[model samples]
Target: MADKAPSGRILVVDDEASLREVLTIMLQREGYDVETAADGATAQALLRESDFDLIISDIKMPKITGLELLRFVREHAPETMMIMITAFSTSEDAVEAMKLGAFDYITKPFRNDEIRLIVRNALERRALRQENQTLRQELSQRYSFANMVGKSEPMQQVYELISKVAPSKANVLVTGESGTGKELVAKAIHFNSPRRDHPFVPVNCGAIPETLLESELFGHEKGAFTGASGQKAGLFEVANSGTIFLDEIGELPASMQVKLLRVLQEREFRRVGGTKDLPVDVRLIAATNKDLATETKEGRFREDLYYRLNVIHIPLPPLRERSEDIPLLINHFYQSHAGHDVKISDAALRLLLDYPWPGNIRELHNVLERCLVLGSAESIGVDCLPPQVRDAAAGTLLHDLPEDGLDLDAYLAAIERELLLKALERSNNVRTRAAELLKMSFRSIRYRLAKFGLDVDE
Candidate 1:
């Protein structure tokens, strides 16, 4: 087979012409684009002109030294990898070069295999760093505030809270119904916090069995229990210096709740079957759908732990309550999941908005995905929606009338209040826009608002 194309570019700098020629030929044969410079000064000139993945320089050189070049690379092009070459007697200088940020060092009498291995390792490390940086940027963009996707008053309040709390060390408790994107909010907080560069560990408190829950949180020593062949670090350890998201936190049993509270209070934990208590510095972000305060009152959850985790509470609004954001969410989900140019008709959108989404945003995402997959390639009409959603718009005005009959005036007033409140919410509490939505004159809207005791100055 033909020699493969060069995978990385390398610059070779040495005082000896023979060593430079040999290094260049060897690295070239190994499929690297090799450039040669007789001294550190020449190498510096070359570096100023173009980029190289790795630089190999001898410790002793004229005009400038290898250490000087290493310092220059560290200051200007820190991402570029450097390897120092030195005589066996001057190996101490190689150590100094390593301290100055050289990737590694090879002695003058180094073997060909040694040179090749070091070069390959340096290039691989550089590639890994680049990949990690790219991934971090992508994650930062993915979880940014722009991705939250809502303009409703409640959601705007949530956005503001997230921004204010993200910089603090206080634990946050995100409460919302299931499928309300609780975990997404957790991720948003983590990625936006100072701990963004560190790990963001998420564990579902309800998914793991009670038997292994402790070990899973606090790790285990070798032979701690059955199948414990080796020592293990826990999620708390993994999340040290970062944030740990405990989803479905209400599902934590009473025993574990006490232990978790201790961790929160003391900032330390002992591994299962271990004698020593290890300190941790992780920020906790807990989420649950259940009424945790009620759980505390019922004695199902610990009171102290509830208060500890509820230092910064973020209550997410359900989809039905934020119906004004439905159209934006629909477009967001469609652009995310639909790969084709598919459109949704106004009738289909109307039914979607009318349906009470008990499962919230997750349900809407799944429904949109289903529509994109099963509905027509061009557009989605009312017939394309699920039967339940379609039928929501067709439901009877009243399921059954009581035999005694209700007060007509009271019923009509309640209806009016509900529509007025909905219109106000949809218009972000702007009375004039709300009046326009209800198709009522601004003066009439003001009178009704006063009569219902719902008046608020603009």
Candidate 2:
């Protein structure tokens, strides 16, 4: 017998005092602290006095039945687990007892093995559920700072910049190519600052129409317009003491830009039909994929508003420029869906790295997910990619290069170097695989590796 067991309290209830004593003694021998009750009313009274981990009760009693005890346990002590015992165990009563929250039902004269197994499994389940909840809480704490996820170098810089400016109450402009997780950065700045726990509203400038933009930002009074139903609070008013993320700020209409600039200069705005000004306390975090500077020069965007929003600028590099980050991002996504038998092959991963990602990180994540859903071989591969990417790879590998009037020897060597690079890439940087593809001995390939500035390890 295993000496070690988890410690918990048990309450035993039976109409017969001898049966109650027997069960209490059995549980106490099994290492559980035990208590006894003569009837359901007594058990209910005991529950009001102190907490117990488990309850074992008889099905039939004169004052209160075990079924009533199960209901009482469910209502009064929801945390405590219960088991029932009965000499006459009908199928419906057994099922009904379970549905009403009895952990298990034991018929008269049950084996000790049956009793031990049921109790052990139920206790283990309770412990396992608590352990799982603790792990999730710890994970959430590590992943979120101001409700944002960023551990890479680019994100570290963003973190520093956000910290520096979030305290000053400056109008911040966040610029990033689309799908670069800019909104996540915005929320982090807002939640980590002093205005945390307040409303943090988000509005898309491009998503809302120009005619309704003013109404959405500054709100409207009852009967303000043709379809006016009642007074509505604007994002600026609702987000008082917090922040508003104005996404795609470059898409704001030129006319609305003047109104936005006025609000930035002063801390107030009037409703659409009301004359009185509404005072607001808001921190603005704006993001755009467009070039606001060029738009300013072209008279499409206001110079004054552009400069105000650019007080603390944060620019996110496109995915191609941050190719080194793919592995990190892949692992992050992997951990989010853990315990699955998922993996990426070296050849498939190398193909992902080599491709110039036009749609950025978002596209990469989508592609990998699709491959997992569609693939049967358990690994993502080059064949899994779309035709456009395959075509691009083919073109790059065979493109004509400048000869520069080199001698025959130099020209041939240059060609060989290019071919070696292509071979290594096709084999996921495996020298042995490259040698097999090139129809050359592995030793011969190694000897020629340094002449072309190629490392066999690469």
Candidate 3:
């Protein structure tokens, strides 16, 4: 099954001594490590003695029937697969064998290739099940709440909010800049909720074409449109009894917004061209990078729809606002992506902390991956960083001096003015945050604003 010799341990049981030897020799020749038993009782003794990947047994045997052995295997070692051998005239018994949990049944006088192929398929299925179990365990560990990674106060608040709202049936609105892990938070909520065992479907509102978005969210009947070939279930139907995350919800067209609101209000929708309304029990989680409240005020977004979706708002702070979390996030990404053998130098870390990550966590991950791939040294130093990050750290607070010998006083004033504007922009025009960015008290910043004839209200 694994594309190599010594595939797996197999047990061959039969009443006929010649058939047992033939099966044992044939399985061994095909690269399986095989053991033989004379009957069901002996096979049970062998099962107790050791584990086997597969067991091929004759249905009619003295002491115990293969069906009885099937029950024993199901009770004791459910993972071991059982294949039944029945007489060609007893086809009904083969169907009964399947019902009793037999992996497959081979009629007597069967080809050797048929038995080999069935065994191979059974072993492959076993291997696949084991792999899926391992992968699920790993994913559960990765997305657990404790692994969210942030000691900052704002992040702690986020965790608290998530813990409180995740188990509820409320529709959640997540607001954050691009690459701020809005979808990750949505997943955390869904995976930690009661409907975790069900599906979690994610759709990007901005990515899909507006013309198809309505049908994409709601099912379409056969011949619904010019190119409609057959009936198709939409994402809402697909996410029944689970969660559906709409990312970049702000980009949803006004027409679709009305439909989405109707679904949220009525808990049901009909197919694009069908008369029957389908009810869904999906938990809605919407995310956006835009200010929906402002959009509502500006008439760009519907006020009622905004209120409906914003039942519980979770706002994520930008990386600049939570700079303290930078080191932890960097270490997390490094440990996750790069091998533990490599280390980031103190100088490099400092530069990374100082750099403005406009692209947020996603950008930081890319930068670290680039450094690890390009650098040969064990330690990642400032030299390993890209020009944008390295040069940003090296740039002075003031602009470069010109060769024309400009006036010192005017040059200093211009530098101060530009830095103030930049700080204001970075802080979303919040006076207090701008003051903090420039390392000035709020009162001092106000006095400077007054001197520049700038309106504080603006």
Give the winner by lDDT. 1
User: How well is each residue in 86-108 modelled by candidate 2, as lDDT tens digits?
Assistant: 78667576778999978888898
Could you tell me which 10 consecutive residues in candidate 3 have the lowest summed lDDT? 406-415
- In the range 1-458, model 3's lDDT, one tens digit per residue, is 55663279999889999999888888888889899988899999999999999999999998898888999999999999889999974677788889988999888898998988899998888787778878766665666566797899999999988889988999999999998899999988888888877889999999999989988989799999988899999999999999999999999999988889899999999889899988889999999999999999998899889998999999998887788898788677667776454566655666676678899888887887787788743567654577677656436446676575545543344345556767888988889999999999999988876654444564
lDDT winner, 2 or 3: 3
Candidate 1 structure quality by residue, lDDT tens digits, 1-458: 95343279999989899999999999988889999999888888898999999999998888799999899888878999999988884577888987888899888688998998888889989999999999998897788765798999999999999999998999999999998889999999998999999999999999999999999999999999999999999999999999999999999998999899999999999999899999999999999999999999998988899999999999999999998898888777666666544566655665676578999998888787777777765676554566567555445346676485644554455456557767888988899999999999999999988765568767
Location of the lowest summed lDDT over 10 successive residues in candidate 1: 406-415
**Per-candidate RMSD, Å:** 12.0, 13.1, 12.1
- lDDT for 48 (candidate 2): 95
Error of 3 at 378 (Å): 2.6
Clashes of each: 0, 0, 0
Segments of candidate 2 deviating more than 4 angstroms: 1-153, 338-342, 376-378, 400-458
Q: State the weakest 10-residue window (summed lDDT) of model 2.
A: 405-414
Model 1 misplacement above 4 A: 1-6, 15-22, 109-113, 221-232, 338-342, 376-378, 396-458
Sorted on lDDT, best first, the list reads 1, 3, 2
